[model samples]
Target: MKRLRLPIPFSIKTNMILAFLGVSLISILILNLFTIHYFSEAVKKDFFTISGEAQSRLNYHLDDYFKQIASSTSTLLKSDLNQSWLSGKRVHTSDDIDNIQMELKRYVAFNFPEIIGMFLVNREQRIISMTGNINTDSLSYRNEPWYDLPPNDSLVILPTHRTAYPYPQQNGTPVLSLLIPIYSTDDLNVTGKLVIDITFSKIHDILGKSALGKTGFFFILADDRIVYHPNQDWLGMGVGRTDLASLSFDREEQSSIQYWNGDKMLVSVKRSTITDWNIVSIVPFDEMSSGLKAARGSTFFAFMIVSVAIIAVVPLVSNIFVKPIIRLKQVMQSVARGDFSVRAVDDAGQMEFQQLGHSFNRMVEQINELLETVYELRIQEMHVRLRQKEALIQALQNQINPHLLYNSLDIIKSIAYLENVPRVEKMAKNLADVYRYTAKYAESEVTIGDELTHLSKYLEIIRVRFPHYFESHIYVNEKFHDCLIEKLTLQPLVENAVKYGIEPKGGHGAIMVSAFQDDAVLVIEIADNGPGISEERMRELNERLAFITNHVKDKQLPQESLGIASVQARLVLKYGEDYGVALHSFPGRGTVVSIRIPYRSPKIG
Candidate 1:
């Protein structure tokens, strides 16, 4: 008998179905993983967004509360009409307190149902209620825990035993009490306590109603101690009992949202800016992220099912087709390990392998081009920074020595005083005016009139000091007085002209300072008829501008160089570089330093 043969069934259609099922399973598994992450992020984002909105609403409530109080107090304070009605009344009649209570109750019913009651206690600690039923005078409420405890310590919102009424089933309700001290109108002396009783149930209703997905618990806390909770029994319970000490909201940082405890529950709490009462909202980990947790679990189950199906079907298919995939995974791992040179090698001579190889080469080329461009930009950025540093240093070194110049003038006054001369006193007065102007408006860009006044003082001081070094004349067009110029700028230029031009050329030499506005530019020209600069020296000066420019470019310099550099720098920094110092000179004639600045007027709001 011949051996029985086992037939192998192979078809293109059968293979295609196996491949399609395999790819679909893996795709679903990967997509499920991504979905888990996406849902988690979306949940956290929504939670934070809602928390912020809740915080805003809480602030609005407090702001409205304060505004109503302030408006009432201001009305009482300003009312001359109500003086006789409010003065020394026994068993109070104005109904101002009653009206205030009614308004407060209305506020609670409409805007802030969170508030329990607001009441005022006078200097005698008399009790008054808006409900109009509970007679606190016979109840001896002033001496009770509610009134006495608050007046003694105004800073703390003291938690006390809940008060019960006379009737049956009128069990004590949990209430948080705050005391705000008010003073006499004139003396600022504390005369009463603004007693506020906040019901825990009301707060719970407001916070709990808005809590949609999660089981949210909120409570009023005084410092680290819990004053009240939604559950009436938990009222006056210490926070340590609830393991709140381990929470991220410690004694401090009660103002913002925080995540606390082992479960990663998000907590948001805020302290009242006026009363220091803490408002806290707690969400448990399970309740807060129930949706996301469900999503993750569902995804995990789907991934496992798909993975198992893929594992079973893959082996029965072609080992040759799967072998390239295994090689591709190894290449990916190598690349992850920083081996960019790693490439997939195809042994089966498949078209897919050829396509992958081409794709890898193209990616490498793009990466290289990107790296080269980044490197070039980095170098160019470094060059620009170097230039900036050089410019900054040059500016710092050329700062004006204003103090030294002032000291020299002061010395001249001292010398003339020792000589017992009256002219010295007159000169000193003029010098004082100049110094005052400089010191007073150091940062201000002054008007032409102010600058001219400051210059006249300087010229008077120089005349007293040198007697007759040069004749000074200033010609400011009346129309240009409205034009603005940098304060004390003209003084420095005039000083330079006198020292370099007039004094060097000897006595009887003249100096001219003129100001005029032309074509939207304020021009001030200082010309001296003296032996001016030589052409060779002018060329030398222009060439040496590079050195000056480089020095100005260098950012590091001593504080003394700060003024000239500062003045030049500020002119450029404020009005742009083109609107500053220009020089023109010729041998045996005169030198002119022209300053052009943008015209601007002071604007009133």
Candidate 2:
């Protein structure tokens, strides 16, 4: 391994002390920094987890509460006595009414303190009240507030609304209803509707008890509206101003940290399948700040103690470990300044130092020997040149086989690819045409029209490969067709566009190949609407292209980027450093790979 030659800023002893101090302090600082960072992130994750659990718990409880109401609605609909009365199958009787009220009171109303009552409305507008005396003498059942019901055949939970009758509701609280169609026992025909009303106060109470983090609260949300909030006044209000509703959250990312009204909040939500409502939790970020502050303070205190100890021990450490190294350096410096005769003689009585001194002295002796063998090296140089010439001849003889092998492989690959898809003869013909264009090595450059023809052949195969999913359009004017460009330049860039934009995603997208002249430079661009390269990937690609363009002999190409890399490299090498390819891209948006080269006037006839 080669040692980095950092310039000396002070005496060797003083540098050792400083280096030890810097390394020790930096290590401690890094450790503490990692500790603080882990602590802060762990705190954040912990809070979100707590909030998520709270939201999930709220969903469970709300589902259970709504399920209970649904169960009762089913029971009432299936009841023999009530069905007969509501369906008008039996004559009116006082005993039947008493039995119906008793059953509802015994089995349903007593269990849920929040339920005000449930009413049965038959086809004839007859009403059966569970709460007790209903003043239905002059009231039309359809005109009542609780009459806002869903489809008679479908079970639906309605949002909370105010009403007068269903009088003496639990403390003037507003009511939400669960509607289940009353089907008769015999024919499974719709008889009437069962409306089960419950108070919003109970939902608020339930939300209050299942608290989340220090400053977090759980509530019920439905389509961006608050069904029930812990604060009773905010019930049935739109929560549009809150971050919980404002951000277009990814389905995969359930928790988000965002700000609303100048306060940062952690919001998490879980949807209740039973109620079809979102159970949301929002916690102020201030709760975690104090805990993080305390943690950072503790880490800083520990770091300070470690730093003080390092300040004291660094000089003592330098004295013991750096003396022998300083002595060896003095000898090496003399050699570096052209005094090759100097050598390390003293070893400080240490075995490691003794071995090091021996190696240094041997290196000096080898340097002296190298100076004396210049005459012999000249004879070897002639032999080396003769071998290089023979190797070049052998290399030229071997180059043709690879081109032949590549041509054979291309035919086999095209046959294999065509056998799996619908288009066989057409794709085979196009693939052959593409390979034919690539086979010629006599002319390194070709006219723009010929390059587009090659690109068209490749794109047709791609269009066939991903039928109805991939498309291509060439918008370059015919005037620029005769402009000269490096062969195979446009095809590789188009392939890159297809690879990035459509192939990985298996989605419908397009590749647009366009060209225009900008003064002396001709710019050809391959643009794709497929998911694009990220910033880091784009930067790395441009850097690789630039590196290959600048250094032509460096053929160590990465497998994934062989096409675009070769295109940029060939362009820059054929022209000059002023010509190469560049990528402009945004992740999940698209990418445009542009090739810029000097415009040579239309090829002479």
Highest TM-score against the true fold, candidate: 2
What would the per-residue lDDT of candidate 1 be over residues 1-605, giving only the tens digit for each residue? 99999764844445555566667766876876688667656655665566646754664564455445444443333333222222335444546555545654664475545445555555555544545433345254543355554344233355634654333342365665556555555555565555555665544545555552456665667776676566666677676777666765553332233456566565666665665666666676456667767776776687677666655765666464556666676777877776666666633444876677667656755766777899999999899976775455334322442333555667777788888877976687677667656556544477878888888888877776567565889998877776777666677777767777777766557779987777778888988887888888777755543334345434443453322334554455446646766668966787897788886666510
Kindly list the per-residue Cα lDDT of model 2 for residues 1-605, writing each as its tens digit: 99999788797667766776687678767877887667656766776677667777777877777777677566656878987886676686777877887877775645776777677777765677776634254263444555644347767787655545635434435667777677789888888777777787667777788875566777666776667766666665677655446543333226666776688776666777777777767777767657767766776787677667766877777677577788898999999998987889755665887789988899889988887697689889878866764453233223321233445545655776767643675676777667667666456668999988888888888988888767789999998888888666787678777777888879589888899889988898888887888878877877877777666533333333337766665666567788888889967778888889887755452
Which residues of candidate 2, in runs, are more than 4 Å off?
A: 1-37, 40-57, 73-75, 78-81, 88-109, 123-154, 164-172, 201-209, 241-253, 260-265, 284-295, 306-605
lDDT score for candidate 2 against the true structure? 0.71
Among all windows of 10 consecutive residues in model 2, the one with the lowest summed lDDT is 393-402
Q: What is the lDDT of residue 387 in candidate 1?
A: 72
